[model samples]
Target chain A: MKTLIIIRERDYVWLRTVFPDIHPLLFPICNKPFIEFLIDFSILSGSEAVRIVSDGSLIDVEEYCDNGSLWGTAISYSSIMSMDDQRAVIEKNRRFCSEEKILIISGLVFIQYDKLHDYKSLFASQPNGDLLVCNGGSLSLTGNPPKLQKNSAPLSLSLIALDSLDGYYRLCMEILGFASSPYVLPGYNNEAYCHIGRNVVISKSAEIRKPVMIGNNVQILEDSIIGPGSVIGSNVIIDRKSTVTESIVLANTYIGEQLEVQNKIAAGNMLIEPEGGICITMDDPHLLTGIKKSGSVRSLLRFLVHSFAALLLITLQLIPFLILSPILTIQGKWKKSKNIYYTGTAGETLTLTTTTIERRGFISSLAAALSLDRFTLLFSVLRGRLAVIGSSLELASDSNTTLHEVESWYHAGVFSYAEAEEWPVSGGDKAIVERYFSVHGNPFLDITMTIKAFFNRIHETNTP
Target chain B: MIFHVDGSTGKKLGIAALNGRLDAKNSSELLTSFERWQQQTNLIILDCSKLDLIDSSGLGAVVSCLRKAIEKNGDLKLANLSPKVAMVFELTKAKKLFSIFTDTGSALQSF
Candidate 1:
């Protein structure tokens, strides 16, 4: 079965006005994107394929769901005019619908469904018409129905128009206050009324009163209180001596020290009172601000310094780099490749040609020990395409995805900040420290970091 | 900000009528003077009815005064919190820590 999810731009216009940069699909009802609920409903209703049709850009949503393979379903996206009616939508997606049963889920609506019930069979057996309808959207059948008539009563589904900031706040409170989820929710089952994601640091003095959903990389500081009802998104920090009750704080937000957050939606620096649509972009960083990875200026500076240092090294080791290259190549121990890597926040992609001498024989071991494989990448610093000391340079592969997840320390560089700190680069704690310094550290600090990293690499190779 | 003590409620009660901005610059002064005010009496009423704006520092100082009064087993109550000041208190959850009244007279009378 195919599912057509239609959400017009007008449906989310009010939300955009209230909270700029918040994609309606990414709006959190309980630390879960509002669209996830719709997706869950489509999957439950036996959708083999789901296509999201929106007039607005679906890049953020697409980036998030990414073909829906995680849920074992095929997800595709399309764009349509905001004025496109039901028939026009069907006509446009008729190619996808083909001969299969198509379920058209329309509007930016919240559907209240029971997880235990067999909605798949119920939907399949229903007549060839609209199965359920509500104010926000409707669930309708677009193909032939099964032969048998299912003896099921019409389910009760209501559309709560999530148009205002107050309405959004009220919706969150209402959902949290409810005993059982009216819809299927993800995460652990035994933990009641909360779905906290990975890598959350809650200080011992911090108090959690339950019925809260906290996302990944969140820091609930000392003497702070969370919940009774709260939904905190990823990469958020609730600083010390503060309290948050009955509110939804979105991703990449920094809640400043000792401030109170009650009954509102805080996305980045903007505090939104959803009902009246009263939004204030806080000028005070101590109250609230946005959290982002460090920019390329630091990386570029490091690159320049490293390049000059690399030039000095090349001039000094010119005979060695030259003499070693032929011997290692002839012995089949030297390998070379070129790949594209993100240089910095400028979003410039650069192709770097690099050579790695295999770490086997005595000469190769000496080269590796002396960090000779990094020889060519150091020249990339001269080209202003790589950083000397910052984040580890990311290869455009699966590793890059993992690096992006770190939130704080994803800037790619030749020499990692973790290496400079002599901290194990793989762990979360080290990543936190490295990321903190990357954004906050100075150029003089970078020089020290690079020197430390160079010596640390020497130490690492000496040990093995 | 102007502050005067009402003595009719069997105890000296300081009514600090805050006006305009009470931010970082003035917050420390408010906190420092709170010590002298405590010497006069423990019962206090911050009449925020005239307060127009408050930042984190101002909120912190008010919370600190409440803590000091509570430690002495006396009390600090708020009266006639304007919509904006009430918002600051509500956001910080400071409203939960104090007894709020509609007017200074009622706060003093209750004490």
Candidate 2:
């Protein structure tokens, strides 16, 4: 049998109001995407193929579900009008539903089923008219009802209305409490109830209770207690002596020391009462707060170290610069320009007199080989303006100024961090590498990386 | 949250109905009043049916209450767990430590 699941945008409008950034299709119910539950139910119902009909964009859903090969079913998608009724939806999808018996599931409802039941046979044997349905949506036959040799035992389907935050929380908790074993949930299910993710650091003094789902990069500090139904998202920090129970903490949240977080949703300084749909954005970091990555000290240290390294380079290249300066000044193969560029942290703009070695002839080649073109900028590092190794400085303009204002993880450097790693200084992967080292690296390591960047720059052929 | 003392089975059991959330803000309140609640009886039944959410701190307070009750040769059992709240207990494996029941009457009788 084939399945056609129809969900209108109006059915899930509550999700957009509550979580503005989250795509409705990606809304997790009990750690599983809302769409995945429908898919699971369809597959269990012995669907040979499944098509999801939605009036809204399915980019996020499509990105996550991706052909549904993992579930051993061919999944497809269709679009319908937001005002389309059940009959209109079926009629629209008539081409797909023409050949076989189609199981039409509608609405934003959850279908609860026993994992032990063989739903394949149950769905196969049932007479096709409204086999199982709830108040939210229905299951009925589109094409001619199939003739079965034997009648199947009927299974019930209830509408789990997930229209409110309270419902969402309750639904998640309900599933976590009982459906843990039966459902394939995200995270690592090592022990019975605890499902942990990668790079979780639990201090020895920290106590963890079971039936918890902890996401990646979680740090449970000393004397803290966790779980008995806690869902901690990625990049969460539960500070010392604090406890978390029966709550869903969204990603990048820091729980303060000795605080309590029971039965609430904490998302980046916003405390949400899911049931009542009330949200309070915290102003204080100690209460509940977003993760602020301040690389000021590290950036300062990198600047100091880079400057010292630059001084050494300047010393080595001084003779070469002296030799090339007069000749290049005569040749015009050397060019100079003055522009204000961003300096790390202080947000101070420095007017840098940039000298470019033109890739014209043998004279320019000799000057480039000696690395003499970088002589002027080395003084700016001496003045503690830029890091010797970091990201290439982008001037602050209205178009790209939003980057700095939005906390760009990239640090402006005399020598790009990507150059040190020999990575192309663009693309998402390069950003990840630069950010990884920028947050974790120290001054000594910076010096070594700067040296590598210098040699890399030497190997790089200078182009326009 | 609601609290009442019951002695129907000849055992003094304090039943506390947790409502909404039992997180950091009010977990200490629960912990602080636990002694006073324990003074009435050692046996306790925490009805979490109305508790919509909990966090690590709230879980700690509950565990701490259990420890305090056990110290006095008393037992604390939970009843009517909301799926969400019960999930925390099961995830932390704290469910193993308590003698949980479906309702307050069963917990009271068990005590």
Question: Which is the leading candidate under DockQ?
Answer: 1
Model 1 misplaced stretches (Cα beyond 4 Å): A149-152, A156-158, A179-184, A257-260, A272-280, A293-464, B1-22, B25-52, B58-82, B93-111
Q: Per-residue CA lDDT of candidate 1, range A1-464, in tens?
A: 78888889888777776554567888887777888888887888888899999887786788788999987899999998878888888888879877988888887777777666677877777776776676667778887667787747465454566666676778777777783466655445467787778889999999988888788889999999998788888889999998888888988899987878877788887777665555666655778898884447855666566677767656755677777878888988888788877666434467877667677778877776666667777777676666667776665665654345424335566678888888877757666766677657776777788778877876564321
Model 1 clash tally, residue pairs:
7
RMSD over all Cα atoms, model 2: 14.2
lDDT tens digits by residue: candidate 2, A341-437:
7776434567877778876678787777666776777787777676766767667666766455433355677777787898877776666767767
Evaluate model 2: give its TM-score: 0.52
- Report the poorest 10 consecutive residues by lDDT, candidate 1 chain A: A401-410
DockQ for every model comes to 0.30, 0.03
Q: What is the C-alpha RMSD of each candidate to the true structure, in Å?
A: 13.5, 14.2
- lDDT per model, in order? 0.76, 0.76
